[model samples]
Target: MLLVFVLILIVVGLASGMLGSLVGIGGGMVIVPSLLYLGLFSISPLFSEVTPQVAVGTSLLVILVIGLSSTFAYLKQKTVDYKSGWMLFIGSGPGAIVGAWLNRFLSSEQFSLYFGIFIICIAILMMVRNYLKPVVIRKTFLYTAIGDNGDEVTYGYNVPVMLVISFSIGILAGLFGIGGGVLMVPVMILLFNFPTRIAVATSMLVIFLSAITGSITHMVLGNINWTYAGCLVVGAWFGAKIGAYLNNKLKAEYVLAIFRFVLLFVGIGLTIN
Candidate 1:
């Protein structure tokens, strides 16, 4: 029975990591919903009583593992932007802690509803930006970074703008049990003028910080289920490597389209579930 459950977790992790690395949404969105469903179905006696908080905490641990796993691939490709990644990380840690603390006040249903709404809003915004007239810009060349495929990646960003985004997204990440890559990736591409690939890679690094910090808070709150997390993490490690490799072959537009679709799907499912 234990082996069967572990095998099931591995399959779930593989699918989550593949989609996460491809679109920068992170594994939490996948893990949370799936785990909840598994709990309802009594897939395992351990999962039969799984609560939203436990699922969220366990998901964060899995994402932390996935982020670390995927980051190695991004690093080898030189796709991870260390400087900008650190900047975002600096702002994310505190926000994540605050979000974790805030989570205690909201009921599980409230959290699910709010997160569902947030996901839908993000999906709509991504699609609208694609079709809408150019949003007015206040831009400055922030810095330069080298990408994996020898692309010259320039950073055109407003420091204040990015800082705010980093902090806010961190809060959302913690509150929703997501790693915030879904929001961060798009913001980096649209607002900072980063290439889609660079944004995806950078988002991994940011997620690393957000997930770890949030996981720590969840741990303190006794929210994490180590048995589930351990199984998920092992599979996520291998899956992340595979996902990162596949990401290199995809086009930017396709990645964005898939990301939007995933968001919409997750949002509606959470709301109705």
Candidate 2:
């Protein structure tokens, strides 16, 4: 029974890691909802009674490990912006702690409902952005960054705005055990005027930072399920590699489209479950 449960977790991790790496979402979106659904019925004595908080915490723990693999892949591609990543990380670190603290108060049903609504909102936003004609947004030249292919890409962003956004991202990470990449990726492209690929890569780095802090807090709070997380991590390691490769291979529009589909699917699943 234990081995069967472990295998199931690994399969979940593989899917989560692949999607997370491709979209910079840190797999929390999938992990949290999936675990919650799994918790509906006891699969085995070794993996019974998976509470919402425990699922969230364990997802964050797995994300911490998955983030490293994703980050390294992005690093090798040279898509990561260290300066921006560091700034975001600074804000996210403390925010994660606060989020974890807040998570203590929510009931399982509340968590599921709210998280479902949030995902639905995000999905709608992405759909609008993708389908609607481009609306001109004001932007200034921030600087140029080296791209993965060794080309210089110029971008701009409002720092004061991003500071607040990054902080909020941390809170989301802690609260939902999500890497906050779903929100960050869109904001980076829309608000910061970053390229889609760059936003995805940089978001992965920030996810790593936030996930580490969030996971630690969850651990201290006794929210993590070590056996489950361990199994997921084993599969995530390999899945991340595949995801990174696919990220580089696929076009930006395709990536966004895929993300949109997943968001819609997961959001509805949570809402109805």
- Candidate 2: list runs displaced more than 4 Å: 131-141, 146-152, 252-259
The top-ranked prediction according to lDDT is 2
Candidate 2 residues 164-264, lDDT tens each? 88898899889988888888887777666577678888888888888888988999999998878888899887887788889988764676677778888
lDDT of each: 0.80, 0.82
Which candidate achieves the best TM-score against the true structure?
Answer: 2
Off by over 4 Å in 1: 1-4, 43-45, 132-141, 145-153, 252-259
Span of 10 residues, lowest total lDDT, candidate 2? 132-141
Tens digit of per-residue lDDT, candidate 1, span 99-192: 8778777776776788788889988987886664433457654667664457886666676777888999888888778888878887787777
Clashing pairs in 1: none
